[model samples]
Target: MDIVFTVLILLLAVSVSGIAIRLLPFSLPLPLVQIAIGAFLAWPALGLHVTFDPDIFMMLFIPPLLFADGWRIPKREFYMARRSILMLALGLVFMTVLAVGYFVHALVPAISLPVAFALAAVLSPTDAVALSGIVGKGKIPGRLMHILEGEALMNDASGLVALKFAIAAAMTGVFSLRDASISFVIIALGGLLVGAAVSWLFSFASTHLLNLNEEGDPAPGVVMTLLIPFAAYLIAERFELSGILAAVAAGMMMNYTSVANAGPASTRIRAGTTWSMIEFVFNGMVFILLGLQFPHILGRALLDAHETSDVQVGLLIGYIAAVAVALYAMRFVWVWLLRWFASRGATKHGVANAVPGLRTATVTTVAGVRGAVTLAGVLSLPEVLKNGAPLPGRDLAIFIASGVILVSLLVAVVTLPFLLHGWRKHKDPHAAEETLARTMAAQAAIRAIDDVHETESADLDESAAAYAADVTARVMDLYRRRLASLDDEQESRDLARRAESLEFTMKLAAMRAERKTLLALRNSRTINDETLNKLMREVDLSETALTARRK
Candidate 1:
């Protein structure tokens, strides 16, 4: 299919998956369902063949995903879970590659050790986007969620880097541990430096533009925010560094620099809506695309039957199974040990809350699913070696990788709900933790509102200042009332929630009225298109806030 038609198909798939997410029973994950749809669509009988080109995949897919992940990671929570994240992302990744690599080589004698390592590396990193479905709907612990997110964010770089070196060794017939280790550090650190620098440059430009357009359009800053990851990735890749790391670093830098935060409320809200759309399309499509590759892998493996040895063909299934089993087995052992050590000197509740027990460790192990990265890595395998012969076992590697990915995703889909279901059965369904979080957020909001008087806006005009102060006072009063009534009384809490919702409805009416006025003025030619768009977006921002509450 042509590129445009391919994109349309993916977008359609994403839209269908989104609708299915709301419609389907809670037990089914949208990714798995969407992938199944794609598999049927891409079957040989259907003739909808979409080629998997690695460079295009890298350029179009990876950067924004990594950047979005880095941007969305809660900074405070990431820091709190940093230790566990590092152990999983770096230590567990290395162990899985070694252990799985050796086991796969042992199982399939035709697969070289380096090629086996490449397959292992390809399958190492978990897809954060795939697992997000489980964490979003399920009541997983907060620390566990953060570590899972944090590990996914970083482990992609580690796994890809390992894959690259292993591929090089496979092609060149030479391998050096010390040189590979040193080069890995260089690539990682260099990517970080480049990413941070590019992010800063973009932030500086965005901030200046926002300042210039304080009372005007914010399109400049919005455009720049969208470009930061692309620029960072391209620049890093040009310098032979890790583009994934570069994109991730740039995202975190944008968060730290407050580039997005510095924009006007309307701009920030609009940008968020745009990002949500991008993430939905990209995330939903990746899994489907991964599934689309299955037919090709199976086809190629069948085609290789006559060329490769009987042993190679015979061992493919066993190798795939061995690799998939080894991944979880190693992960379970590593996490269980780590959890036990971390639980020491900590309370039973606290430790379990953070790391949980053997059951949860098993759940977490299953959830480390391989998806797009694994497919992309194996698909990028060289077609021919330096000696001009076809790369041995390329089809086998792709087949093995696809099988492992599918198995891992299947395991996660089958196991997560049952595991988390049992875990939640023992806990209070009406969680107190959520209420505590709400109260703390409201307290912080009130504190910020209290400081508004010191701003320049408070000194501009008496009426406006008084209006602001009055609004803040009323909001603070609602929060105080809500706080005082948190006595495990469901009726009182529900009443407060309804009151808040009513307030939002009333505010939404004002925003709609403002929007109508702007439209009227624009129709009369009293305001130009630029001013109209700006004012309309501001109204839309307020409307967005209120609409969220109404929902």
Candidate 2:
């Protein structure tokens, strides 16, 4: 009963947070708002307290979110940005671990090198979700956003893997750079393979065994899709591979699978709606959970430090500030070097204005906001060693990690907007490609309609054939007008667009009338609720389609 009540409260909180953000006088990021709500709920008067379990949190929230990102990210962009993503996700992660690890150890002499490394490892993975929430969609340049998203997707695995080794070293008091390197390779590769294989297997089963291609309820297939990430994550972990990467791989694999495309329209619609809801609820809950934990983590740590000495509290805060700065500095330098190298190569190829810009690098650096994964990884650190002795730096590391997470988020919230102002104000880069696609698709649709018209009219009677020809012309005219609207000639495009606009107005009016009539029938009890709903849905779908095309 308690568990159920807690979940309902969380869900209600998530829903309320969504509404509350819009109601606020000033704009704020959704995650921050959710976190604030969580903190408010955790106040003593409110008495809401939820235990934070790192393992369960990671298992429940991480996989589906990562999978969704992989599925949605443009494959072409991901491939193009592969080099940069790898440089950040793999190279920068290790660099941060080594450089920042040693820096942390030096900064706090009490913390062992292994524990410091673990701290750095957890901090290495940036939160693209948080960055997106802060910046909002279409605010960032498309190419840069893709690279950042790709980096966030891949680095979670690398960072967590590093933390695993660091934890092992701390426990056993033994370390092997060579073995760790080799193991990292095997683990990462194995995870990728396992994830792709699992996705493929699901696709095969859906098509061959489940026969989802045939018309039926798509709920089963949608449910199966929901399970893929968890399955991939658990399976990869069972093999001691990188479950994060596995989940990512499974999501990316979804793009190539026929399961999404081959299914009924209802399936696609339901799956899309289901996933959207899941993403929103899960994302909100994760931040809220962070918010719930933050007050306790920060307050308790600060209180303890204060009890010892006022100086100790300041020292704790100073440690957080120093670590946060070090992370940003390391990230900035690494990103600058990567861009500088790329610029040199571009200049060699005769590309003008190829020098790296300060704004781009700074934006990239600031966008590296530590989030849920960092929190989870840091909290997952073992409290006791093999000898049953307390881990020396575990508590302090958590405090620092928590502080850094808060600081990073605060920094990004403050800095990113000013840096991104007036950035990417130019026309959409993909406009031409989109136009070309629309024109080609319109032409193909015309051809298909014409072919079908001919086949249907071949053996018909004269009157029937005449009616078929008229219907065909009407259908094909829609595509012809669409093509004209996309034409290079301004006058023709204007005329076609005007016609389309007038048609849209009429269709919208007609749909409204249909809806009004259906509602009237339902109100008068002349039509059953089911009948009204069926007709209303048709009207709604038409209006939706019409409005979408106009936009």
lDDT of 1 by residue, 300-334 (tens): 78558647777766666677777788888899999
Please state the error at residue 343 of candidate 1 in Å: 3.6
- Per-residue accuracy of model 2 over 195-232 as CA lDDT, tens digit each: 99999999999999888888888999999999999999
Which residue pairs in candidate 2 have backbone atoms (N, alpha carbon, C) closer than 3 angstroms, thus clashing? Answer: none
lDDT of 1: 0.81
Question: TM-scores of the models, in the given order?
Answer: 0.82, 0.98
Q: What C-alpha lDDT values do all the predictions have?
A: 0.81, 0.94
Model 2 lDDT at residue 256? 87
Which candidate number maximizes TM-score?
2
